[model samples]
Target chain A: MSGVRVILDQDKCVGSGQCVMTAPEVFDQRDEDGIAVLLTTAPDTGQTDVVREAAALCPALAITVRE
Target chain B: MTSDTVPAFPMARAAGCPFDPPPELHRLQDEAPLSRVRLWDGSTPWLVTRYAEQRSLLADPRLSADVTRPGYPFPAPGRPTGAQKLGFILMDDPEHARLRRMVTAPFAIKRVEALRPAVQKIVDDLIDDLLAGPKPVDLVEAFALPVPSLVICALLGVPYADHDLFQGHSRNLISRSVPADQRGASFRALHDYLDRLLAQKTADPGDDLLSQLVTRVQAGELERSDAAGIGVLLLVAGHETTANMIALGTLALLEHPDQLALLRDGDDPKLVAGAVEELLRYLNITHTGRRRVALDDIEIAGVTIRAGDGLILANDIGNRDPGTFTDPGTLDLTRDARRHVAFGFGVHQCLGQPLARLELQVVYSTLYRRIPTLRRAAALADIPFKHDGAVYGVYELPVTW
Candidate 1:
């Protein structure tokens, strides 16, 4: 669980911004459309739990986290 | 389930406990998380009462938000079911996403955060008006309704002077007991009003949302009718939902003095933010469940839902689900209640949530603190609760300082 990778499916994203709210360090929404943009594909150990929570909270199921 | 066994949809909340969801909803969640409930039309839609199931099903592509769909459960009889009437909220994605995205930038978290100072100013000015005005003022009129209405008016480019036209019609639109023709008339009134306003914005574009919508229309990215519809949605929802939350949240806080003390005495922004989420969770203003229809067969909790089956995600009780929140009945401001689905769960979840949150955070943080002696001017029983409306709140909250 040391190295965590996050993938956001832009196609499935509905721009709910739950991921951005939940894990600001790992996700940021594009200014133009509010679609989520991954700040880091690989989140550090401290950010892993919140990244997982963001993935769980994403309404569109657009965020995927692999550890 | 047999008709005799099926409980009617939109069950009434217990007497004297206006803040709680219908007791039957809690029982259903405890006993059968997914069960059938009879609607006004004698149609039984599956009522998903549990939090996890609701979030899962709401996110499922198999469910469609199109109001015109055959099995879609209308809140009441005689209500119009036009998907265009409320804009993209009643439509599913590709289309929902397309129309919703056009206006998304304005309500994005960052954009809404920028609105905090303006909202705070509005709250402060309203509280000033309340303090200066006669004692025992109707908070709904003197404070609650005006806050969101003024903010939305500025944001949507709708004139605050025309508040009566929009507010009156919106009142008719959300009341479940309103006659169908009256409701239809109200819908048209707001629709036509917004249409005319959009036309005005087309001629003299302003630095607001409707004007931005006009820009999309000129670029051929959005239809004029659709732009009007989006205006109607934003106008009605932006004001009605948040206004009710302010009044209702204030009432809830007044009843719980300790909670009020925590909010009124605390200087921490995090404490205020948590209180807002807890209030949103505890007092789910949208009590009439989120209505939807199944687009494809789905199986959940050992129940097989047919493609045409209608579904109601009762997020009020879902927020109260014991599995999700411990001691769900209590209103603890300190509780980590952010996970609650008061605004709902899924792509079609509240688009105005950021704005709503910002407004509530400002009000909850500032109001009680500013007016430390704020109390109910009328007895709780004398207060008119909006039990018949699609949104739950007080019609008028009389308050004194």
Candidate 2:
């Protein structure tokens, strides 16, 4: 269960909101400028697949999903 | 380079691979002529990558997209079969033609053209919402992505409140990394939800797309499942595809500053339409091609494919084939990019295509003319590209004016 991890390079994140769009529960963001920011430092088990998608979905390659 | 060329690029590979398709597809077209590709599922089926061959094959009846009936090529082991084989679009022959025709009336070029004024208003509203906030706005969340979702909801007659549920599932099922095995569940869940919503529409019809379909279906003409099939298809295809186009299309326009300026200065619908085609061709999303199964022994694009073998028509590569377009790799809005298969080809060509095109042309023209200074908020390399999914699209494209 602890094997799941997704690291987002915020510097690389252009806030496409794709990761959040793909897995909203796993990836949430601030409405500061309408872009997403992760709300949870550690995503739950149900979010494992979603996080993987969020990472894969990122256009900037900002997200790195590690399992 | 014979029957065996380099391995065909799988969707997962394309998502992450920093490679372009023209060279890879060209090599296959020249060398393999007819070749096999490894799909998300373990099965490796023959692919037709050349321009003439792909078109020739797409138009051929021997190939089938429906995996429902027997004598079809089912998925191999754990690899994904499409989520419960939707009807009509993936179906062959008269069925595809028949079903596509049902809703085509509402989506005709002229019908969609009439919707342009309304679509422009939607774009303006979303853009206003984005600007109402602050800088570094994620175009995907604020404007580029949600506008299409909202429009489709209104078009389909789905209540605005239900978007969160359906959109969440739709996003998950389309993501490349969600695994082929999981899509079936996500698809079924959505279908079940729509089935109930559709049944309600049958009882209490509205003027939206669902109610219209329900009225036709209850007349005992179109099957209820077929009606539901159309609903499900539109539910997902109606928005996500357009959302991706807007996000990626905007990125493409920004990348080509000259093209962006072209839109800023022109009000010509012809020019806008041509630019939309170029964007569709250049940013073609159906990268894996429409899935089709051969009914019997056949030879296509110069290769021998037997009965029960699968067929794939690499739309993205075909749209980019140098033979089809002069300097296919470069983005030239002025180029006559018509006849591209970004909406797909043959009987199964995208039914929502005209509607999608209308949304694209209007938004592209309006977005730039209103905010001429719109530019990427981050570096191209700084932003990541999608690595997996049923659709090929960018994640988020942030922009600032």
Candidate 3:
């Protein structure tokens, strides 16, 4: 089985909340500036679809996922 | 013209006045075929007001979105000064095309279509919160802002906990008159914050948009900086603009009860799409688009625009053009509003458009269906309209069901 890890291009983050909304299990946001901080260092396999979905939904194109 | 002062561009004057821009331009379309006018920033630009002309100019290769042109009027300071700019919407062909390409895949139909159900769920949840609120509520605060902002949050992999801070900065940055220096700092703040967040994403990857960019960068498809810049651009453009539209569009519906009634009566996506189009045309939240500078001499609308001139495509004005839209002042959602320039045409059209459309489609349809009796709490005239914003939105749109 592959391990899991969450990646974010914070530089490209425009503070849109797509990731946090879809996968709160994997994403935690900084409300002070609307920036998303990945919650789990390496999320479980079950969180992959939500993580990918959040990444795809981001308007800033700021998130990435890996195993 | 007065001794030291030149006449302001008709489009701008119209923006300042509560009148239709096309009619205002029509008064001068012939007399002053082309006029050089000053922007609020003291920079002179060629204001393209006519409908056909504005459309032609946007697609024209001679004009560029690059703010690097010598004497190019950077609307507010702290802008990516001279080639250091990360905001891709301000660039020309190859660069604009390349950077745009990076973020395009996420918004494609195939990609965005999958997000529909999730977006619907968010809308329903938000509506539940709205229903639980005090009798009188400002829809802008209660529903309009959070719905899309949260959706955008979910898509970008940003933690929802941080929305308020970003929302605050976004609100101020979009204002017509925040100081240049302050705007610059805020932008840097956005960048620094994003950088920190991106670093985290890079170390421990997540399957979000940021992670996708990281893969491209690590895979040698894109540079680390390009990925970062795109993230910031998407972050701001994704939610802020839509938030404005949702708020203003709702106000537009409330102002015209008949249109509101029409929307409330149905939940069809196609019908809702039409309503969104009409709302974009009618409200044109971004009253005037970010200015585009002319790269060379170009002729538009039978008027010759000199080289090195700046063009501010006033979309709000184009939407109300009598020549194009019949009964421009009316809010007939059924009007053939697809041709409107609210989204701007050609290469620089909004990159997040599909997502925006999805959000609007979901929000507008769900809103009226859930709050069927939703009505403006105050008279139309009593509601404060945002006239001073770069993207003209209302201060509050109080409603009661």
Measured by TM-score, the strongest candidate is: 1
What lDDT would each prediction earn against the true structure? 0.90, 0.71, 0.71
Fnat values, candidates in order? 0.50, 0.00, 0.00
Residue B58 miss distance in model 1 (angstroms) = 0.3
- For candidate 1, write residues B1-401 as lDDT tens digits: 58978999889899999999999998889898799999989999999999989999988989998988899998887745553368998888889999998888788777888898999999999988888889999999888899999999999999999999999999998998789889888888888899899989989999999999999999999988889899999999999999999999999999999999999998898988889999999999999989999999999998999999999999999999999899999999999898888888788888888899899999999998999999999999999999999999999999998
Which run of 10 residues does model 2 chain B get worst, by summed lDDT?
B11-20
Q: What is the lDDT of residue B69 in candidate 3?
A: 75
TM-scores vs. true structure, each candidate = 0.98, 0.79, 0.80
Candidate 2 RMSD to the correct structure: 18.6
**CA deviation > 4 Å runs, candidate 3:** A1-67, B1-5, B9-34, B77-79, B82-86
In TM-score terms, candidate 2 sits at 0.79
- DockQ class, candidate 3: incorrect
User: Residue B167: error of model 2 in Å?
Assistant: 1.6
Find the candidate with the highest lDDT and give its number.
1
Residue B41, model 1: Cα distance from true site in angstroms? 1.0
Model 1 spans > 4 angstroms off: B79-84
Worst 10 residues of 3 chain B by lDDT: B13-22
